[model samples]
Target chain A: MARVARGDRAAFAEVFRHFAPRVKAYLVKSGAVPALAEDCMQDVMATVWRKAAQFDPARASLAAWIFTIARNRRIDLLRRERRPEAEDLAWGPQAAPEAAEALALQQDAARLARALSDLPEAQRQVIVQAYFGDLSHAQIAARTGLPLGTIKSRTKLALDRLRHAMGRE
Target chain B: MTPRPAPRHHPDAALLMAHAAGTLPEAFSLVVATHVSLCDTCRVELAAHEETGGALLEMMAEGGSGRHEAAMDQDGVLEKVLERAQALPEAAPPAPPAPGTDLPEPLAAYVGGGMDAIPWRRVGGGIRQAVLETGPDASARLLYIPGGRAVPDHGHRGLELTLVLSGAFSDSEDRFGPGDLELATPELEHTPVAEPGAPCICLAATDAPLRFTGLLPRLAQRLMGI
Candidate 1:
């Protein structure tokens, strides 16, 4: 990300190679046709390059940050509506994150990924459908039979780990 | 200035998840965004959901290359994106909010300025509202209730989200101060009265029209488009 922010085309190309296919797949699962998904995926990558400088590893992982970009682009292209984003918090004197904090966040992200893959099939399916934009909160509640609180608690365990790593607690 | 107290009430995990997934209706999204701007607790929760989304995206990538081969023209897309990147200028950082503005940035953009700039219309009972333009899925409004006055009793047909921005209000549930969010489902019914002191200001959103119980308020609802 630092290299990409410095306008390194090679770094940008490497990032594109890794994330482009994944973002395209996400769009397809969300109900976009192939051609539209391709177009939208390209737009998302361009935004990644443009906003590289704004990426803060302390706040979010690279994949997580990219997910937000792709999510916003999907809204623009697929839904054709404006998304209201929360105000950016002022981090006060620390313009750049501490190196140790960034490393800890990355490790926490890896653990979260493992935990997600290990979830029971039914639970994982519920999460996938919800994040893929195939289900709304109401539909998820109605279809899963599992109460929303149960799902929240499952995810909250991982979130608590992340919060501790980020020193929020 | 003394920092505002942290919000006690917040939107549940389901709402935060929908917001992170980009599936929330625009009106509801506005309320979530405005509330999250003021509440760090909710912001962290939102980040957690976004992290989950990232993990899901990664898992999809690992599923197989078969889907990727069918959907994307990789070299062609990369070439186009790179071409665009070459011509793109550096993205400028977003401008800081104006000093002394009370509304959150997202809500401020919709209002076109600060609270004083809203074109409020009287909706009866010492209450005023400015309905914001959003998608057909839901409606959002800025509401002002004079101190010590009670908003008409009402129930929701669908979901109703009320986020307090200034002062406080109390209903059958509890007192809600600045940054607090009150979620009302169809089963809940109550009359909210602003506490004495400052007038209560809130950003409220509803998926369906509010069901006012009183005949007079129902009449006013139709006339005022509440």
Candidate 2:
């Protein structure tokens, strides 16, 4: 953060190297078209560069802050793109075909892999379906026949548990 | 000093865990921000989650080539971005920010709906409240009350999301500054007081009325406890 605050372009690039692909992959899984996801990724990095001095180590880890930025960008694009309701269902289940590109997310990859692998079948299913499969809580509820809120709550619990377990206590 | 225990209404380990894992919904994300505004335990836990996220990303890169059979430019992006940053004009003059605010760009984009200008309804004594419609759905709306003013002690049967946009508030855990996300489940109970010096302002969303728990709380719930 200090380096970034000092206008360290190299430092900013390192941050991008760490998070951009993962953020992009995340957007793709969340229903963004591959191109749009890439665009958001770039925007998030730009924001990171512009706001690096604002990064508070006492309050936020870099990843959390970056991901929050990515999440916000995702939301902004979703708001701006003006997709049809017919495309909503189409959005889910459309994973990025660039499996080769999924290879780009280099930060924290192994821990997440182990965590994803170790997840209980049900939890894993819910999370994969929700994040990567592009399904919403309501959509997951419909597909799985669970109540909408129940699916949401349970999915949330599963993701948290997996992240915690993989990250350790 | 020893850090305080988290507030009762603050989200538990599970919710932060999911948020770190990137599985929580946008609607739910708002509520989680509210509790995190006041809860450090979850915040630290979130750091742990990020560490894990970093580790996970690294491991996948080295060990999971099976997913990518074709030649690819995943590394190319890293090089490209680095080159671009390296080429940026060095040490340009920094721009001065606007006044009375320290919001991030995204929050700045959302700084409207005239929260400061909205008409607040007095749902109960000493409590000012107002609800506005938003895009996420019927459930996606902005609800606000001046912070530090004790709201009626209440719990929700459904998910409730809060994000502190301005001022500050505190419960059992910690004081929440701007940009904090708080999530409350059906089981959690919350009552927050405004921090000294300013009226606490937050953006909140919920689908159901707050269910006042217990007799005293039930009676005082109208006063709006957080």
Candidate 3:
């Protein structure tokens, strides 16, 4: 990312080669059509190239930062296609994480991945739908035929379990 | 010695997850991001969510299709990126906040100059507000209430996020100090009074203009452009 920030074409190409397919695949899994995912992937990679200077390693890891860009761009694309009337799709100013927390988080990435798989099936389902499927609480409830309150509690409990699991590490 | 109490108010898990997933609306995301910046606990939680998102991406990469096409168009993608990068503004990121202001880096950039430079307009009842240009459907503002001042009782037409930056305030919910976020929906209405001892400063956003209860504030709402 730093090299891309310095206008290194080679680094930028390398990044696109590495992340484009993964980002598109992620978008497709999140409900975007293959063509739309590819289109959004192109936009996301372009944004990564343009906003490289704004990427703060102290706040987020390279994978996390690129994932955020991809996720947000795909969401914007989907929202615009679905409801163009109210979707502003403007980039908002985001805050930075403290240095210590950022380091701890990066260090614990593997533990976090493991902990997620350890969550109960019900808890994991709601969380996956919320984060990866981009479903709102109500939407998740409707899709799963669960009550809204149940969905909320499941999500909260899933996060608590994650927190405990990560803290134990 | 024990550490200070954690922030009493926070964005819920769904909101935080939505934020990390980058699916939150622009205005709601602003408040969440600002609060996450200031609150270490939320920052860590956000990181975990981001990591989870990254893991999901990896899972998709292993199982989902389109790798062959991605390889084929990698050069085209890089060219488009290069063209886009050339058109980006050459301006640098905003400088860090100067000493003493409670505004976070993101809010400071939005407000431009320093806190003192904020263009506050009186909205009556000893409360002052400086509306910011967040977007058309939603509005962001900085509210300064003198110690003990009270905002009119109100409910939301959509969603309202009020994040305290300094001092404290209380409504029907609870006491809110710095870094506390009070999320009011259409179902809840309460008059928020600034806690005594110091003035209360908040960065607030609303999807729709507040539904002020008192006839006077309601009558003046148009004049105040709230």
Best by DockQ: 1
Ordering by DockQ: 1, 3, 2
Q: In candidate 3 chain A, where is summed lDDT lowest over 10 consecutive residues? A: A81-90
DockQ of each: 0.59, 0.11, 0.29
**Per-residue lDDT over B98-198 for candidate 2, one digit per residue giving the tens place of the 0 to 100 score:** 34434322233244323454556665645555554334432433434454576556678777776665676776556666656566668878877777666
lDDT of 3 by residue, B172-204 (tens): 889999889998888999899999879899988
Select the stronger candidate by lDDT from 1 and 2: 1
Ranking by TM-score: 1, 3, 2
lDDT per residue (tens digit) for residues B1-226 in model 1: 1278889999987789889999988899999999999989999889878988888888885343465564465666677898886676767876666677768888998898888889899888778999998877889999999999988899999999999989899999999999999999999999999999799999999999999999998997887686
Docking class of 2: incorrect
By TM-score, who's the top model here? 1
* Model 3 lDDT at residue A35: 75
lDDT of 3 by residue, A10-109 (tens): 9878887777777877787688888787777777887788788887766566777888877767756776511111111123475554678667757777
| Span of 10 residues, lowest total lDDT, candidate 2 chain A | A81-90
